[model samples]
Target: MEQAELTALLTAQGLRMVDEIGPLATTGEVAAAVSRLRGAGHSPDLVAAVVGQAHLRTRAAAKFGPFADRMLFTRAGLEQATRLEIAARHAARFRDAGLTRVADLGCGIGGDALGFAGIGLDVVAVDADETTAALAAYNLAPFGEAATVRHGLAEDVDLAGVDAVWLDPARRTAGHSETSRTRPEDWSPSLDWVFDLAARMPVGVKLGPGLDRGLIPDDVEAQWISVDGSTIELVLWSGALRRDGVRRSALVVRTGAAHEITAASDADDEPVRELGAFVHEPEGAVIRARLIGDVARELQAGMLGEGIAYLTSDAALTSPFVQSFRVREAMPLKVPTINAALRWNGIGTLEIKKRGVDVDPAQFRRKLTLKGDASATLILTRVGEGKAAQRLALLVDRV
Candidate 1:
């Protein structure tokens, strides 16, 4: 959002208008809003700001739910903001650790700050971008004295009286609408400085899930979290906030329930075996945290192929950490052979999942003339070792 647009949206009329209009979920609704607002003698800047925020709020509903109706967002800021439920879990860590005051550095639009304050903790939310900070202050206004937002660099923010720190370093270049990812060296406040402070005080750092494991500090607890099967973030916990004897953790939050699997370190991988009655795909968080071995043991399963993450077993049962598929039949990877089988089975709806192949599922789907009423999942993956390795297409049903 530009300064002029932001300025226009800060007025009494603008806020009321946005609240009344709610989310413009479609392009036609947005166009109608823009035309109507502009026709009513409203300035172009106000119309743009209102329309942009309305659309953004519609998109943000997936993350914030109904709370999105009252929030304001910039495209890039909303993209980086943590989900409200995820933020609450982060807040629970601080609360569970007996921390009361927190300094939220790089607080984008006060998402985490709201979480902190919602849990009755005092929060000092700071952001480098003036527009974002202003929006953060606005978003956090509901909390009144519990939340205090400041516009300043994270390194420059005073930490006096704060019990702990919450760091979300800016990982992208400066922008309101569009930004590109920055290298680790280019991160705001720098990881080196952040890690140094974390060593001296209690701190929780939110990072991208794909962060290099080698760079993680030895004393900190590294946790990967997945929401509805999508791996979302990796959080490094230090000092009193770090869970004891849990160096690596995978948290899976589905619906409103949360399940966790924690280990002191990555467990050993199970050996490869022949195809079994069922194949399980480890959840993204479990894969990222490298704790598939733990789940495999629980299900009495083994790797489907060497170095592959797929687990196979004849147990006819599965765990929450994996999506179990009952094997229907295994066929050659050739398109024609598979098409004949699919047609014979009357398969029309296909769900393609691949692990070690170069085939584009969309393009591959186009090659087959799907004309029946049945549905099945196709697993295109390489099985067996070295010279025996072959791309096998397995037809299966979700268990």
Candidate 2:
């Protein structure tokens, strides 16, 4: 809805018209109210309210909150925010690099800005969207005078005295006219433009986790970040990317402890192996740090298949990155045996993970009859017996 009408409705309802509604209202009720406004063709303010509410509810409910307040709404465009730890890492990196004062150019909801301020660093968080700037203010409120939220274009913002700048361009393409997306390139200020700005000041560019490694600027430390097992974000650290593989690091953050995987050596090295009961998957940051082999060595596990991301162990080991499952049956790859085995187990839930297989999981599962209450993970791969084969890596649970 239009801001004027939305303001009026919020005033009438005594709602603050903030980033999201914290009331325990159901989505159906909110959707119905929004639908009524839409039916009247008045485009009520409840549209944003409903959207915001729905997003918050879904996000807060997820084991991992999907929303990152650091996501920016800059003049260039809107973009997703980075995870807290990832943002904090960047802030720490900049601080250690001697960047005393920094400008989060496209500071979205202030995710990274808060990280910077948390470390007692000087940060000027800038965003072009009024709504975003307001939200960022609330998110960064605890920082007090140490952090400031400004609504303006990055190029237009006065950042003369800052030693470093961080930017996350809006990466959504223009095709999102029918959706909520802005152009992907617009997510941050133009890269070329920002590059010019970075020539004078140190800069950090946050990009998609799946971004092409080739597109990474040579001078920037291109680092991919994965939290838990899920790869979340990639960071480009200009003035920090090192030839000796220094900037990239993989980290696994947990409730109790944190593990790290440093960058790989330039020399070709063998994978680490530990004869353990279970193999652990390294944290995403660890994997991105090119320390997967290092982790395997640390865990004393060996690779099961060539380029197989899974680590295998005969000993019971507790690690965050990999899950442990019993090799219940090592039968040859056959549909009849697979189907019979699955049906015998009453496989109600089937998780198919394959490294080198052409068969579709849906089709494979469809051919198998799963009955009663039971769950199992069916692994399909080329178990080279002169042919590719499928095996059931009976999963116990996420390690």
Candidate 3:
């Protein structure tokens, strides 16, 4: 934002425009005021931060009602906040390896740095944006000397040979939305750069969960993490992957609870279990890691059809990788027959599960005219080209 416009926003937020004061104020009070200012013109960062403030305000206003004024800005409200689950897993993994000191490259909003401090690790957090870096310092002040924030690029930062280097490259450009996908080449600390960093110290790179699995370098162990049942981000570890073989993992985080399912390594020689009566489908991370075969073997289940992402058996099995369901009924390998079976089951809430089918769920659900209080998961899949089959699945509660 321009100097005059910034001054006007500061004034609107109750900050006096001092003759000697600069356009961007570093004082905490002025910064906090800028967070609440509303106006016509705004930079993308300002707009994004303000929207984050609104989201925070909504939650604060709901809980405190009129007393929300007491609610202050948390580092999470800042633009660089990483999802809590992603940060926690990194902290846990790093700490378990006895790495007490860490450098958080691209430490936007100091979220990962905060996670490091929360786990009692020392952190040197760096960000390219001056405003974000300043705010990160402000937010990290409460850590009482545990966290350090700097403004710079990853390549320029002094590594000093720390235990691990945590890098969350800017997947999108400064003004882009979180959903906006960017190729690895577009990233600031490019994939090649990250690999270079790994050559020096163990490096962890945060990626989108939807990232193409093939693009992940063989030397980097990829991990897919989720929070509250939604997959959030993928993490890639170089230097460590070759030694650990823990290539892929699914992590679930919730208040007072945490669940992690790691990929089976070469040393984990447990034989694959036989196909069971019912099959369980694993999370995206599990499937991407090609661990489905291992899961099927673990549950003693067989693939339903050729190349399907589903397991089949007659008995119920409990596994964290995927939801377990009992087979209520089976129908002939025909669309009409499957549609008829759905109606007979009195299922109104039809959750279509297809491994290899090309039919769209929305169209199939609309065509079926599903109706009732009964909730069931239906698998509309191929038994063969001319033949099709439908199986009603019984949803099991997560353990």
lDDT of all the models against the reference?
0.92, 0.59, 0.61
| Cα distance off (Å), candidate 2, residue 374 | 4.5
For candidate 1, write residues 1-399 as lDDT tens digits.
999999999999888888888778899999999999899998999999988999999999999899899999999999999999999999999999999999999999888998999899999999999999999999999999899999999999878899999999999999998899999999998999999989999999999999999899999999999999799999999999999999999999988789999999998999888899999999999999999999999999998887778999999788879999999999989999899889889998999998978999999989886869999999999887677778899999999
Give the alpha carbon lDDT tens digit for every residue of 1-399 in model 2.
234533443443423432334432466866765665467564455455544444443443332243432221222222366656667777888878877788888787677887898788988998776666765776687778889889888879877788888887656542211235454455557777876765655788877676655566555556666555577777766664232555455556565255555553421223423223453444556545566676666566666555545566676565654455655555456778877777776778777766556677787767777776888666665432223323434333344
Q: Give TM-scores for every candidate, taking all chains together and pairing residue i with residue i.
A: 0.98, 0.74, 0.73
lDDT of 3 by residue, 1-399 (tens): 223332232333422222122222234644544554434445544444444433443444432344233222333333345644456657877888778888998887666777788789999999886656765676577787779888999989877757788998877666312335578789888877887777767877887788776677666677776555456678888764233757666665544366666664421222223333465666666665556666666676766655556666555566666667676666654566766766776767767777566767777666675677777777665432223443333332222
Q: Superposing all C-alpha atoms, what RMSD in Å does each candidate have to the true structure?
A: 1.0, 5.3, 7.5
What shift in Å separates residue 226 of candidate 2 from its native position after superposition?
Answer: 1.9
Off by over 4 Å in 1: none
Q: Deviation in angstroms for 222 in model 3?
A: 2.8
Q: In model 1, which residue pairs have backbone atoms overlapping below 3 Å?
A: none
Give the local distance difference test score of model 1. Answer: 0.92
Shift of residue 224 alpha carbon in model 3, Å = 2.5
Off by over 4 Å in 2: 1-26, 32-43, 46-51, 54-79, 95-100, 128-131, 137-144, 174-188, 192-200, 240-247, 254-257, 264-289, 313-318, 372-374, 384-399
Provide the clashing-pair count of each candidate structure: 0, 31, 16
Q: What's the C-alpha lDDT at position 253 in model 1?
A: 92
- lDDT leader: 1
